[model samples]
Target: MKINPLLVGLFLISPVFILLISYPGFSVVDSSEVFQVFKFTFHQALVSSLLATVFGALAGLSLSSIFDSKKYSFVESLYYAPSFVPVLFVVFSCLNIGNLWQISFKGFWGIVVIHVLINVGLVGALYSKILIHRLSLMNRLSLVQGLGVWRYLRKIVFAHTKKDLLFLFAVVFIFCFTSFSIPLIIGGVNSTTIELLIYEKLVVLGEVEQALSLALLQLLFLVFFLGLINFTQAKEKAITTSWNPFFKNKIFLLVPIFSFIVLFVGLWLSASFSLGWFTELALLPTLIKSLGLALFCGYSIFLFFQFIFSILPHSTFEFFMSVYSSPSTVLIGLALVVVSSVWWQGRWLVLLFGYVLLYVPVLFKMFVQNFLSSLKPALKVSRAMSANYWLRFKMITFPLSYSLCLFLGFLTAIWVLGDYALASLLLEADSTIALVAKNLLRSYRLDQASFVITIIIFCEFIIYLLYKGLAYVGGQKY
Candidate 1:
């Protein structure tokens, strides 16, 4: 696998450039204030995840009650829509309407609402599946005798779902905890998160040492949670190869899908004056940049997956614990590994590390990481005696990781496309599509911004389809 010169260059430039703008100095070290902020971010996320999970579970359970009805299928699609949209669009649409009504999307509570709204769909979707699985299991048991609804839930629902629920909570909590844009845009001084604060330390404070300190700290927190998750984690679920096809009966299910369409469409029409002017502008350059960053972001996921594939034996979660027990552990661990292996030093590695930090948890909570981690241990033992790098990877790593690398790569690519925070920090003035999207939005060209967003998402959908095709050929069986 020859490295792409452009990707290497971009990776090298993105993080290293931070050193130029970043302030390496700090006012007196307020370990106390930093600790307080740390405590607050976790506290808020815990509240947000718990409350949101309840709402999400209720929302998901509502779907279970509605299932087999023609209108029910639309429910999941509606729940999924917000999760797919860029957060900025949601914030803008909400703010546009709220302004007309003189309501505020500001401070802590507002941030929580947005977090819940964004994450509930994900939580709801997963819970719906969990509920559906429970229902199916109960159906199997009903052949012999009736289990009361409460008994069914206690024995089958809760009994079989310890790992799934643990996975969901871990996910929603980390997402809220590390969240950046929603909090940054609407948070003002009253709302903050570890991700936003890291941005502050790096971009605002210009404190490199402190920024790195904070980044290191954030990394440790994530690894800690990752470790806890692995402790409770169960065996990996095999990926379902069959796609559920949409049918005519599912047409009524479009109610929620249409509900979603109507909502966003209404927002678009109401904000037309803002969006109209944008639709007329030349977006070719910005389109190209968005595509470039998006492509590069996709490429980044593949490379990071390689790194993930590198440390297979001890669950990455377990390694995370061993590595983050001390900051020196991370510094030393990398030193003996990738950092010392090459001449490179700086933020590209950090940015790549950021992507790992970015994807691994969400993916872990989603169970993607766990699956990847599961395959590599046996593969690594095979590699220990292999004669060549490619031979070892091809025989042991890639084949074992066949389904994961492809799916995770594509899923993460879609994710990285919507990544505004990482793009904001790393991309040069005109290099990033997200920056361009934000530029358009900031410039009041809402329509063109929507166009750009649509195009980006369409590209992601297309890329994912392509990856799915390749996944079929791999014979690894997803």
Candidate 2:
């Protein structure tokens, strides 16, 4: 539980990555070009995630409808298959399909379609499930009263739908806004995203200061928007997610069937009806690489969870509130002095640590809340027993939480391995499989791009299977 001095320095210096990356002068940056560029980036991503969410909702609705319960289960499983597949795979699949339709995958609209198709499955799946559950519950009452489905939705469905729709749009905006791989791969010079620009300035141009500045600038903008969303949401009435979803409508029913036709057509154009994709020997190496990365990432995430849980028993707000408020730059200075005295020289490790801090809020919120839910009752029981912290947590908490924690770790890693921002920090390493995949696109080798994407899809399916396994196991434990 002891804090390492080396980690201390890295956490302190994290923000400088952004400050260092900006162009030399804010004086000149004020020209309309900067504002225009920023506006373009924001609008494109906003539009994309929104559309993706609508499609995602439809995607979920489509599968959840039409099919009977038994067959719907199968369709539901396939409906969500896209979220795991890498964005590049989606792009290449688009490219292959485009050749037949004469559709070009090179512009803003084209990129949006790929992002929507690939990621909407999650929004749809979750949204649909919630809707179906509610609908089933509402149906019981409606059937008794002889009220119609529309009446139920207008009263109940609308409320639930609003929350999910808002949430889905917010998330879609963030993903598209921050996305690197998909935009960079399919976007020609005409379609450069802020991430690509950051990469160009920092990695390609070696303008670390400018890149850091831009990165920081983008972060600030995101904080501002996020703050506004929070403020607006706070002003509104609080609506809890109702664990119910209904989808007996005709429009919702035919959606997944139509989507399947679209998906099938894309797959057909992509694979070109060749069983070669099924038999290719090249898939093995890429698969091995993806599996290795997923495993390491998964394990690392679990270790991190274990480390945090052991070190801090208090709420994360209580734990980080003290440290986060302090200017990290000052802390880094102290950490640097301590490291020097200790003869440590892992500056790169320090950078990695900083990124972890930057990304911690999202992942932490997702897992820590889950962790705490299980801890509350145990802590209370310990209170009754007059047991000390370690005694109660050791016997009750750790064992009970480790499996779910492992499952959390696995899901987090799968998410991280595909995480563009996290992977961006470590892209220089030989183990940068995502970077290697990006490089495949760089070479403009469509066939090679095809290979990388095929492998990505396979790896995702494995991860998805593992996640479902974890979900099943976790469900049983509860």
How many pairs collide in each candidate, listed in order? 8, 24
Candidate 2 local lDDT, 300-377, one digit each (tens): 666666655554445434334222221222222223333343444654344334334543444553235335544666
- Candidate 2 TM-score versus the reference: 0.71
What lDDT tens digits, residue by residue, belong to model 1 across residues 1-478?
Answer: 4343334324423332343234344444367768777877887788878876766665655555553544554566577767766676667666666667787878777777677767776676667665554355454554247556567556765676667677677777777777777877788885666666666655686554665566566756766876787677555443332212211123333333443553375356444333444345455666665555555555666666665554444443434422222221122222223332353444344444555544543554464444554465566666666536567666676677667666666666666666666655544543455666677777776766666665665676677667767877877442
Q: What is the TM-score of each predicted model, taking all chains together?
A: 0.70, 0.71
Off by over 4 Å in 1: 1-36, 58-80, 97-103, 127-139, 142-144, 235-267, 270-282, 303-357, 369-403, 443-448, 464-478
Deviation in angstroms for 284 in model 2? Answer: 7.4
lDDT score for residue 381 of model 2: 76
